[model samples]
Target: MSEEEWIVDGIDHLNYRAVEGVYLSELNVGLKKLILHDYPELSDSSFVSNVHLVKYRLIFMKNVIDKANKKNDYVRETVYEVTKNQAYETMDVQEEWDNTITFGQKIADIVARFGGSWTFIISFVFLMAVWMAFNVLKPFGLVFDAYPFILLNLALSTLAAIQAPLIMMSQNRSSDYDRLQAKNDYRVN
Candidate 1:
């Protein structure tokens, strides 16, 4: 590719002036595709992959190119406004928060974070002590979770299952945000 190729990820808007055999419309299509695939929620408008979006951007770009070739000042201004508007419209609601949040799910978040090897070992030891205490204190019959604490086991199992998915969801969101930020930075330079 030539140094003249304007590749903007998002910064101040990608602008390339002069030279090139490639159609700006094709370039825009590729860009939209990248955005849609990388960010699924952004494509919810049912138009992110629409041919019209590509055509609109291309027509605006072509207008600017034609005017620039003809040394027309108004053409540059017109294309700038039109292209900017279209691009903004396409980008407005591209962020999707599908599996984002809930209030009482904090327990899931905590379990997901500390349910690793070390945590499991520590919990096992703690449960063991609790079980021994229950046996020793059985004379008083005050053991809430006794030797066969099926309910307690079920609760932990359920927590691990739910928390695991939420943690994955959070990780995915972080990855997406990082990608979006990187794209924005790329566009600027």
Candidate 2:
């Protein structure tokens, strides 16, 4: 091409021409918008040389453009697709999952919280102390559960059976949430 034909004006009103076989002025408007969106600091300032902008766009937006092209999406305007993908990727999956949790899951979380607290421990200790004291101090014929405390044993065993599963369910949910967070972080990075 002639030198005059090679020189063209960029979106920022700066003149650019073929540099190392890359033509900045020939870039698609959508790609220009994507470059601007990716680098807000470059949006307002005119680049001293077109070489830097061309190199940056090629290095940074190549993957995004290729992915958009592969999906056959944003063929006319890649900025929209890129922005939409970024928004979706950065969304809080944990909050969305928490919102979708079932009533059973909420109950399991509550049970797990209460089971791990000092209040449960203190109240259980107090109840056992009172039970032992009453049974030991009362007359022999009036004692309902003797020193063996079979009723207490059965109740404790049932509580353990129910509590173990609830705690495990909550832990599984916590692990799932952590995994989701890691996935989001990986995507964002």
**Global Cα lDDT for candidate 1:** 0.55
RMSD of each: 21.6, 14.6
Per-model lDDT = 0.55, 0.70
lDDT of 2 at 83: 65
lDDT of 1 by residue, 110-184 (tens): 554676559777987898677767765786767666666766788779866876787786566557766765776
Error of 2 at 106 (Å): 0.7
Q: Which stretches of candidate 1 lie over 4 Å from their true place?
A: 1-128
Candidate 2 residue-wise lDDT, 1-189, digit = tens: 544434333334456553423343345666556666655544333332455566656765787778878777545467565567555545779678888899999999999999999999999899989888878888665787887888889988999999999999999988988888888787775
| Model 2 CA deviation exceeding 4 Å by range | 1-89, 139-141
Report lDDT (Cα) of residue 103, candidate 1.
56
lDDT at position 173, candidate 1? 54
- Which model scores highest in TM-score? 2
